[model samples]
Each structure stands twice: as structure tokens, then as C-alpha cells.
Target: MDSELAAASQWATESNAAVFIRLKTESGVVQAMDSEEGDEEENEEGEGADVIEFHPEFTYPIYGEHERIFGYKGLSINLNYAAGSLATYFNIKYTKRIEQMESTSTVALKADDIDTPMRQILADSVCATQSEFAQQVVHDTRVFRPSGRKVHEYAGRSSQTEQLRYEIYSSSFNDTESAKYHERMQAFVLFFIEGAQFIDTSDERWHVYTVFERLDMNGQTSYSLVGFSTVYNFYCWPDRKRARISQFLVLPPFQGQGHGSALYSYIHAMVLGNSDYADLSVEDPSEAFDDMRDRNDMRYLLKHNAFAHIKGARVEQSAISELQHTHKLSRRQMTRCIEMALLKMIKSVKSQEFGEFRLFVKRRIYAQNMDLLQALDPDERKHKVAESFASVVDGYRRVLSLL
Candidate 1:
């Protein structure tokens, strides 16, 4: 133990970093030595003596003794001594520790730390899910693929359809600075796809996929393609916690042909199989549907499922106030003030970080939306929208503090 402490002291002296000496035995002891002057101070002149001192530059004055050391075995010794500017030295030492522990530990990766492979998959999936033209291509491919025929023959019969699909799915544009504005649209597509979550099954793991199908009409066949991406918040708070669906996308042409409904049904069933309880909120009815017709279609589909609205069709300001009061925010004026504050928090974030923050807010909105949806009352849905938006704003503020 004496040899080990001496070695640690030597390392501290040479590297100009802090050193801690831990003694596991009752006779074991800890001591601090000044790097500037190899001077040692004895602690109380006792038999099982342990001494520790902090350099002047360290935050805490005189690192003498600690009540407890975190994650240490036996008589753990912790030393955080370093030479040079305090911040820089501490940063370097902390970084070294982090790097050393990264491989063996299940550390959470920051939003910025998400890698390129995951990013690319997410982007592709988002584009396929959100774009109307992309959705159509996917739908066309799935619906048309069963009949085997020549591509040209099918195109000849349905030139308009084929051209529309081709224009939407096959067109390519240069990414160079000289590319035309229309050419730059491809980049926007790429950006949106990449920014969107392909597989947000959880904060820890994301999955993305590009889907393609061949359609056959009589003897002619054409190919259609689409992308599917999902972001799941699995085990976000804890490993045992249930997962939340962050994002789901299917392209435009696929909208009315039961593809979206089918996908949702499949997901719903899958989730139901795994757990007796699962929930998601649909906050953006506008984004969810291309038009009123599409929205109505979705309404019909949702109605078929056992899902019901929580309150009723329309959520009024009064209802929100009532809910707020129930939560103990009580004063109507105070709740309004709080709501405004939350909105400001969200709006204050940098544009690039907005999307990330938006995901966090959307989950809360969804939860509120589910309450309204489950109510199966028309008035409740309207009120739920207002309530849901308020909840989103409030949730955004809370997320800001986390950053």
C-alpha cells in the first residue's frame, strides 16, 4: 500500500495532475504532497494516519477529507490535482477519464453525438414518410407490383400516372452551388429526411429503412419506392419504462390507399402484443393529412380502432384552465402567464436545434391529443386541440431547462 501510494504520488508529480491515495486496510492511510515543494504534512501524528491537502488552485480549499467517495471500493482514494490553468487541466483530466470509461459503460450519447450512419438512415426515412410524392411512389409500387408485365407497356397505358410517379421519385438534381433552384429541391428533401427521425424507437437506438416495391399491370410492370422511418423513445427515463413512438411517416400517393392505415394498424398491433398499455398523440392533424378528405379518411380509420377521446371533441380555453387549476397552477392569470413563458422558451432556441426540441414538445402534445381522441366526442376534439397546443408550449419550456 505504501508503494502504491508512492507510485501515485510520483505519477501526480510528473504529470502535474491531482493524486488520491486510498488505503483499504485499517492501518492504511492517505496523504497529500505539494508538487511545488515535495513537502508532506502528517495528520494528527496518529498510527493509522491519513492526510490529504488540496493545492491552492483547486476549487475547494485544502482537500483534507471527504465524507464519502462515489463508486469506490474499500478505502477509496480520490485525487483531483493538476497543474496549469484550473479549467484546462480539469477538462483534460475529465476527458481522459471519460474516454477510458466510454467503451465499458452505457453512457448516454448527446443529441450532437448521434453519428453519421444513424443520421443518414433517419434522414432517408423522414423524407419517405413526409413527402407526398414519395408516399405516392411507395404506394404505387406496393399496389401495382403484383401483376408482372413490361415497364414500357404499363407506362404506355398510363403515361400520366407513370410520368407523375417518375417526376416525383426519379428526378435528380445537382448539389453543386451552380445547380438551379429546382435542383436544390433535392437538397431540401435530403435535409428534411435527414433531420427527421427514421427510427426513433428510443433516444438510445434509431432505425431507418428505404422501401421499394414493383407494381404489375396486366403484362407491364413499373417500380415504386418509398421510405419508412420511426423514432422511438424506448427506455428513455428508465429501462423498464415503456417506449413511445416519436415519429411515423408514409408518403403521399400511399395516403388514401390504406397504406398509412395499414402501417398504423400493424404498429398498434405490434405494440399491443408487447404490452397491455401503449399511447401516442397525434398533434398535427394538418401534417398528418394532405387535405380535409385525407383528414376525414384518417378520422374514419381512427374511429374503427378502439381508441377514444379523453375529454370530448372541442377543448376550450376554459377547459384548459380547469385542467391547469387541477394541477395546482390554480390561478387562471398565472396559468396564462406560464403558458406564454413556455412559448417564449421554445422560440428562443436556435433554429438548428428547434427540430430536436420540437420532438420533445410533440410527445406531450400527443398525450393530450390521445385524451381528446379517446373521448369520442366531437366537442372534445376541438377543445383538445387548444389544450394540446398549450401543453406543447408548456412542455417545450421544460425541455429548454434540460438543455
Candidate 2:
């Protein structure tokens, strides 16, 4: 019995490794291959001709905290999508599944069944079988104009002669047409964003923004879903409101090409243009998103005349107030932007300006963590503040380089 129990252990596989996700396009322009070894691969023929294979960063949301799938050997779960419309195709396969029960003359042992847990997690309308998914009918994205008011359009970052065009559309959850698309698109937040949950769509305060790539090929035009963002409007007072960005994601294959920056800039512009939005905020932004936000925010400040002359280590209260009221920037965000602007002006570390900047950062750090720092000895508090200042400087330098 001991030997038999030990043998069962080998059947368990890491859920992250066993799962394979892919995007298949009708033009055959994008393809992601699955492998038992789980190595990353990208097949690029030219611009937008590659599909990068990836695994889930966190599967705890699907398979519990340990993220382990038991009772199976050689398991492969594929979650495929049609590129443009994002129609889903889900398929699961396994070489050997442990029998659910072991019976004897007088004793019986039962093991847990697989597939039941996953079926409940995935979307109900996904393709049921591999064969059905293989015959997927691509939606007519050419005529599929996004349902909402067309807001902003721009050229791709690397475009010069052949400008790659992209458009952004905004809609509210109240729109029935847009809500249907949101239901199909929300699954991406689960797969990509950490600690993300589906929002309550019944609420009228929820809004969505979608990005699509406009492809004009051989006298035909089509739009491909590149990424999207969700925002919730909270009433602040009698008339004011706060717009908080809840979820932001750029598809894996379409990432690192300035789509995230474009999406964020469009959302930021909407907030700045609208008088109803008192301020803009984000809900639990990840590190990568934070870095992007920092870069974008600083760039905006630098372009404006108010922040162009900011050079001192000391953060000015008047300037902070101006940013808060005029640009809808929060106090914390304005302070960070001021620090980054000061860092950009520094010529050398040995200069008096650099020394003042370090001191300024240390004071801010100490004030923020005063309650925790007061618990420690005076000498230790100073040491902790210095460590935090060093970390902040390192991060600022990294974000500045991206600009």
C-alpha cells in the first residue's frame, strides 16, 4: 500500500506547465506551438508576423494556491482564440488519468476527478471539442465596428511611410452591445492580470475602452483586438466623480510595441478633458504598469510650462496644488513626478543639487513610514530611511531611461 501511494505522486504535474494558451488568426499570421518542455518560442517572419508562446504567471486562481493538477499524467490543456474577434477554443487532453476508485472485497478508495474544476472556471460558450474548435468560423471584423463613440486614433510608434493605424473606442456597461463584448473579453483579465476579478456589469458606473488594430490588406480592411481597459466611475460629492482604472491588458503577442502607452494616454486624456472627473486613479497597478504610468505621467508634466522650470529638491506646495486641481493628479502622484523631474535635472552625484535631492527623498520616506520607523531606535530609523531613498533613486533612474 505504501509503494502504491508513492507511485501516485508522479502523476501530479504543475498546472502552469500543463496548460497551453494560443491565438490563431484566419490569415495564419499568428501561431503558437505547444511543447511538453514548456520552452518559450516566437516565430517572426516580418512585422506582426509572429506569435509568442507563453505560460500563466499565476495559476493559483484556477488550481488553488499550490497550483498543482493531480490524477493525471501527460496532461495538456490548450486555450486557443481567434485573433481578431477573440472567439475562444478550449481543449483538454491527457495520456493517462488515474481511476476514480479502487475496490476490494471489503474496502474502497476513491480519488478526486479532474476536468470538473476547470469546466467550472472557463467560459460556458467556448468550443466544446478540439474538432469543433479546428473548424472555427472567424468573425467578420471588417464590418464589426466597435459599439460606442469613437474617441481617439493614432499612428504606431515605429511608423514613418506606412503608418500603422489604431483606433480606440469608449462605451459604458449600460450599452447592451458593448456589454456582450465585455463578457467575451473579461476572461483575459483572469488569465493575465494578477488578483483580478470580473466586475459587476449591472452597475451603470462601469465603463470600458477597447483598442483594435486596423489592417488594410489587399483591398480588404479588418480590425484585430489588441488590448482593452476598464474603468469605474465613483461619485465623489454632489457633482464630482473619480475615474479609477480597474483593469488594463495588452494581449501577449501584441505587447511591448507601445499599445499599453497608447491605451493609457487615451484614458488619461478623457479624464483631463471631462470636468466631471475630479481625479484619475488606478486600482492595484502591477510593477510593470506602475513603471509605464510613471513614464507617461512625467512626460506630460515636462511638456507643460508649470513643471518645466521645476529643478529643486524641495517639493513646492503651490505647484502640487496646481497639479492636483488642473491635471487631476493625486498628491502622491504629483510628489513622485516632482522627484523624477528633479532627478532628470541632476548633472552629477557630488553636486550640492544631488545632495539636496537625496535629503528631500529621505525626509519624505521618513514621514510616510513614521509610525513604523518610530518603533525602531533613532539610529535604525535613519538607516531604514537611507535604504528606502537609495531604492527610490534606482527606480527613478530606470523609469527615466525609458523616456
Global lDDT scores for all candidate models: 0.30, 0.75
RMSD of 2: 5.3
Clashes of each: 55, 0
Off by over 4 Å in 1: 1-204, 209-213, 217-223, 236-243, 252-258, 281-286, 289-403
Query: 245-291 in candidate 1: lDDT tens per residue?
Result: 34344433334554444444434444445543233222223333223
Worst 10 residues of 1 by lDDT: 82-91
CA deviation > 4 Å runs, candidate 2? 1-6, 29-53, 100-114, 130-136, 141-143, 156-164, 309-311
Tell me how candidate 2 scores on lDDT.
0.75
Model 1 backbone overlap count = 55
lDDT of 2 by residue, 1-403 (tens): 6655566667688888877766555444222222212323222223234333456766777788788887787787766665555566666677788775342333343333446666665656677644344345234434556677889988754333333578898998878778877877887787789899889999999889999877665655666778999999999898999999999999886888889999998888899999988888899999999999998988887777547656688777787778777878767777888888888899999999999999888888888898999999999988898899889999999999988
Question: What's model 2's TM-score?
Answer: 0.85
Candidate 1, residue 189: Cα displacement in angstroms equals 5.5
By lDDT, who's the top model here? 2
